[model samples]
Target: MQDGSDWYGAATATFGDRVAGAREALGMTQPELAERLGVRIKTVRGWENDTAEPRANKLQMLSGILGVSLTWLLNGEGDGLDQPAGEAGARLPEIRTLLSELRDIRADVDNAAERLARMENRLIEALTEGRVE
Candidate 1:
């Protein structure tokens, strides 16, 4: 957060941007966030991907839990988080490197989830065909 920027500002950031940035700023993993929200990890992943949205109740909870205003999360209008202040210049490269690694890890997680779903579907089909005990 030492980059001296509104990493999740309203300018052109989407809801996903706010959610993911806030989560990372807080050092919360996706599974941790899901547990706190009483939802599946997939739900959190979808939010991060901008592929789905939470219901109103979940939305309220999300804002509260994430320590960000609802308006900011929705349309980036109200209060949003600031990066943690510190010596940034020296760590800028490291932060960028870690962020890149995090993205790659997230992609792998998403891929694994999709593969798991496919495997589950295959098992279900096998059961339906009376091929599995």
Candidate 2:
């Protein structure tokens, strides 16, 4: 599995198979990849076991970290690992930083949406109770 040819076959590989193959090709342990992605090791295990899939943002980060295209990561059919390991490592810091910012922005948006929902509920209750008249 170290060479990424382990997945070559007539049948289409599952998402987990691609993930495991790519990680193995990169010589990355599950723990190492999880730490780089800022996720728990169990999360990586879940992905590799086909028990879970990463969120879109995490998938993007995983692609970058694994030096494979997102399409390849998902379906195993695309430009996979065109870059050497050193080149991939060179781009990792930038990609990680951008991903972190995106995550923070997403969190803020979620919090704002929650607050708006609460406010809307309060307004609806007040109106229905004749308190807003």
Candidate 3:
């Protein structure tokens, strides 16, 4: 005798169900998850519908992004939304690292833009100071 409650558990849930559960448990929308994964919304939809499966690289990234183990994401056997509190805390380090990297990249771009502006100003000054040949 089995009640339908099992359907909601990872043990009997479909792949799509697990994906959607993890995404929601992380407080992420489909679009946000897709953007983080660098995938199209349609691709995400396909995955959630069980029409497709992510490749190994994407699977690894998906697990990390969703703060779940690969096995849990695949078969609901390891660690899924069953432990939401711990999962959320586990993702902090990765998020912090990503934020730091983005800050470094932004700084590099700003420095390059400033150097380009200075070069342009120097060129303009030289052109205005000299007579045309």
Best by TM-score: 1
Ranking by TM-score: 1, 3, 2
Tens digit of per-residue lDDT, candidate 3, span 4-78: 223324454567767877888779998999999999976786677666799999999998998777887777776
* TM-score quality measure for candidate 2: 0.54
4-121 per-residue lDDT for model 1 (tens digits): 1354455545687789878887899999999999999989988887768999999999998888888888876667776445775446557756765665688688889899999999
Better of 1 and 2 by TM-score: 1
Question: Which runs of model 2 end up more than 4 angstroms from their true locations?
Answer: 1-10, 81-133
Better of 1 and 3 by lDDT: 1
Candidate 2 residue-wise lDDT at 56: 96
lDDT score for residue 82 of model 1: 66
Candidate 3 ranges beyond 4 A from true positions:
1-11, 83-133
**Which residue pairs come into collision in candidate 3?**
none
Question: Which prediction has more favorable lDDT, 2 or 3?
Answer: 3
- Location of the lowest summed lDDT over 10 successive residues in candidate 3: 1-10
Residue-pair clashes per candidate, as listed?
0, 0, 0
Task: Give the C-alpha miss distance for residue 35 in model 1, angstroms.
Answer: 0.8
Superposed model 1: Cα runs more than 4 Å off: 1-6, 83-112, 127-133
